[model samples]
Target: MALRTEELMLNMGPQHPSTHGVLRLVVTLDGENIIEVQPDIGYLHSSVEKMMEHRTYFQNVSLTDRGMDYLIALQNEEVYCLAVERLAGIEVPERARYIRVVMNELQRIASHLVWLGTWGIDLGATTVFLWCFREREMIMDLFEQVTGGRLHHAYYRIGGVYADLPEGWAEQCQRFVDYFLPRVDEYDALLTANPIFLARTRGVGVISRRDAIAMGASGPVARASGIALDVRKEEPYEVYDRMQFDVPVQSEGDCFARYRVRLEEMRQSARIIRQALRGLPPGEIRTRVPMTMKAPRGEVYVRTESARGDLGIFLVSDGGETPYRVKIRAPSFSNLYALTEMMKGWKVADVIAILGSIDIVLSDVDR
Candidate 1:
C-alpha cells in the first residue's frame, strides 16, 4: 500500500467572495475538481417562521412574506391571503386583483434585479451589479408611490390590497416600463453577449429534467434544466390564468440556460404587466377582515409562482385566531438543495457560476 490518501479539504466561504452572503461552504477538492460541496446555512436564521405563530393571521402575512423570497416583498403575503381566504371563503374585489398583478410583477422586476446584480457579481462582472441596481431603484420608486414603503410594503392584505393603485399610477408605470424595456438590450450588450461571459456560463452546470425533479428543484433552475414546472401556468392562482405569456424553457440545463431564462422571463413579466394594466378592471382593493382572524378548522395549501418559483404555503388552522402551523415551501430553499449535486466535479470558479445559476436567498433557505 504505497498511498491511502483522500482529497484535500478546503473551506470556501461563510465570508468568501463567491459564497454570496454569509454562506460557509465546506468543499472537498481533488486537484482542481470539487469532490463535494457541503453548504452550511442557518447563520442568518432569525426564527421568522417561529415568529409567525406569535403574530395574528393578518400580522404574520408581512412577516412570512419577507422570508419566502426576500427579493419580492408582499408576494408571499398575497399567497397567505389566498390560503386563508380559501379557508374562510372570503371574496376579493376585481380592482384588488388588478393591484395584486401590478405589485406582483413590479416586485418580480425588483427581485430579478437583485438576482441579476448578485449573479453578475458572482460571475466576475461587477459593473452589471450597478446597472441592475439602477433599474431596481426605478421599480422601488413605483412601489413607494403606491404603497408608501420601499422594502416590506405590507401592501398586500388578507382580503385585498392595502389600498388602490395610487393617483395617476398607470401613467407612472407606463413611463417606467417603456423606458425600462429598452435597457434589457443594454444588459445583453454588457454581459450576455460578451465572449468571456459565454465561456464561463455556457455549459457550466447541467442538471437533467429527471434529476432536477427528483432533487426537488423548482423555478428557473428547474426550467432551465428543461423542466416545465411553473406554478403560474400549472396551477393558476391570481390573474395568471387570463394573462398572456409563455414559460421560457431550455434543454441545456446549464448556467447560460438559467441566465437566458431569467432574461426572457423579465420580458414575460413586463408583458403580463402591460396586459394587466390595459385590461385592469376596476373594483375594491381589499376585503374587510378584523385585526384577528379565526380560520375554519381545515388545512390549505396555497402556491403561487413567485419570482423564484413555487412559493407554497401550507397553513393548518385549528379553527383558532391564528394558524397552528405555517409551512412555507420556499423555492430558493428547494433550488439550493440541488447545488451540492451540481457543484461536484466543478472548479472553484465554476462554483460561483453554479450558485449564481441556482439563484438562492439565504433568508428563504433558513426560514
Candidate 2:
C-alpha cells in the first residue's frame, strides 16, 4: 500500500510566545516535517531612521534607545554616537574610551542574559530563565548606578559617556564580574550537557557556512556556522584592539552550536570587562560637546560589534544640528532573514528551538 502526504500551511504567530516579539511565521509542513518558513515582519515598524532625521543629534540618541533593540540599548547609543563623533571629528578622552568599552561589554552580558533566560523559557527550561536573570539583575544594578536608567540608559553621548564613573565604581564592577564568572559555568552545567537540551537543539535547523554568509547572518548565528566575521576583531573599534579576547566559532550551525557560541561569548565579554577595569585610566569621562552642535557636511558609516552582531549606522549631515539622513544597519534585520533558510526542512517542533537560537529582536528587525 502507498500513502500520499500533502503540505499543511500553518501560521505560527503574530502573538505566539516563541516568536520573540510581534513576528508572524507562515510555515509549510508535511505532517510534522517543515517544508518552508516565511517570516512575516513589519509588525513593529516605526520608521526609526526618518524619525532620527527630524530630531537633533542629541535627541536621536534617546530615540535609538526606544526604537532599536531595547535589550542592547547601550550598543545602539554607542553606534549612533560613534557615527556622530566621526562626522564632527570629535575625540573621546582616554578614560572615557576605556569606560565605554567596559560599559558596552557589560551591556552585552546583560543583553545575552536576557536572551538566555527567554530562550530557556522557549525550550521549556524554566529554571534557567530564573537563574540567568538573577545575574542579569546585578548587571542592571551596576548600570543603574552609572546611567540611572536600567533598560534605556542613553549613557553614551556624542563625544563620550554622559558622566565620569563614580568613585569605587570600578571595584564594585570587579566584584560583580568575579561573582558573575562562575554563574556562567552554572548555566552550562544546567543546560549544555542536559540530555533533553541536546536532543532539542543538536542537528536541528542547520545552516551551513556558505548559506550563513550568503544570507547575511552574524553574531552568534554566523559564528556558529563557522564564519569568523566579527566587527570587534576585524574592524577593532573602541578599545577592542587592545583587549585580549577570542571569537568563539562552531561549524555545526545548528541550534546547539548557536547556544554554545553565545555561552562562550558571555565568558569572553566578562574577560574583556575585567581587562578594561584593570587598566582603566583616571581622567574626564566626556569631551566638551555643545548640546546644539552641528556636524560638518559629510557622510560617515560606522560599524561595531553589537550583542547581536555587526551593527552599523550611516549618517549624512547637511552642516546642521540635525542629520539629513540616518540609516541603521540592524544586525537583527539581516539575521531575521536567515531564519527562512535555517528553518527549512526541519520539524515543526524544532521551530521554537531554531528561532530562539537566532535571537532576533523584532524591533531591531522592523525598525
Candidate 3:
C-alpha cells in the first residue's frame, strides 16, 4: 500500500484583520503544518523619505508625525529632531529634556496599550481589548491636554518642544500614573497565567538567539530572545540616562516571552514617567530658533527607542532649507522579515497568534 500527501497553499491577508494592515501572507502548508511563510507587504507604501526631502526641517515634523509609524508619532519626531539638533549644535534646555522624557514614556505606554488591546482581540480575549483601551484613553486625554492633538502631535521642534505643560498637567499626569499601575496588575491576573493564553503562546513561534540577532530584531522581540539591546540603556537620549529603569529580557524567545517583555515594559515606562515628573526642572520649554531651520552640510544618523523598536533616522543636510536626503530605518520593516522564521513548522491557526505577538504595524513596514 502507498499513500500520497499533497502540500497546499493559502493566502492569509491583504484585507485580513490579523495582518494589522494591508499585509498579505502566502503560506505553504504540508497538511496542518506550515512548510514556508512568505510575507507580502508594500500594499500601504508611501514615499515618506522622499516627502521629508521636499519639506523644511520644521514642516517635516508634521510629515514625520503622519508618515511613518502613526502610532509612535512622537518617537518619529524625536529622532528627526535629534538629527537636526545635533547638526545645528542646539542644546535642549534641562526642563524641556525632562518633559520630552515624560512625554516619550507616556507615548510608549499608549503605543503598548494599543498593542496589548489589539493583541488581545487577535488572541480572542475581547474583554482585554476593552480594558486596555480604557487605560489608553486616559493617556490620550493627557496627551491632548498638553499637545492639543492626540495622535498626530507635532509638538516636538528642531530645538525643543513647541510649548510648556499646561496648568495642573503635572498633577494630572502623576494621578494617571498612580491609577494606571494597578490596571497592569489586573491584566496579569487576566492573561499571564490563563491556560488558554499559555497554551496558544508558550513554546510557539520560537526564535533562537542566533536567528534573532542575525535578522536585526530589536526591542522586545530581540530582548525576548535573550538579546540585551535596548537603545535607551545602550545609548541614552533626552533624560533617559538620568532616569532609572530596567530593560526586561526573556530567554524563551517565544510568543509568551514577547508578551511578558511588553507587559513588564509598560510598568517600567510608568516608573520612568514618574521619575521624570519628580525631577523635571523649571526652565524655558524651547530654545530660540528661526522658523526656517537649516543644519550644517553633513550627514547624521540618530536612533531612538520607539514603541515598535529601534527607529533610526539618517539625514543628509546640504546647508539648505530642506534636507538633501532622508532615510528612515523603520523597525517593522526588518521585523516583518523575521516572521517567516517564526511561522515555519507552526499550524495556520498559530499564524494569528505569532503575528499578534510581534505586534507589527504595516505602516511601519511599508514606509
Model 2 spans > 4 angstroms off: none
- The alpha-carbon deviation from the true structure for residue 90 of candidate 2, after best TM-score superposition, in angstroms, is 0.5
Give lDDT tens digits, candidate 3, residues 142-259: 9999999999999998788998999999999999999999999999999998999999999999999999989988888999999988999988999899888999999999999999
TM-score quality measure for candidate 1: 0.96
Ranking of all candidate structures by their lDDT, best first? 2, 3, 1
Please state the error at residue 275 of candidate 3 in Å. Answer: 0.3
Q: Which stretches of candidate 3 lie over 4 Å from their true place?
A: none
Better candidate number, 1 or 3, judged by TM-score: 3
- How do all models score by TM-score? 0.96, 0.98, 0.99
Among all windows of 10 consecutive residues in model 1, the one with the lowest summed lDDT is 64-73
Error of 1 at 225 (Å): 0.8
Which 10 successive residues of model 3 have the least lDDT summed?
1-10
RMSD to the hidden true structure, all candidates: 1.8, 0.9, 0.9
Error of 1 at 63 (Å): 0.8
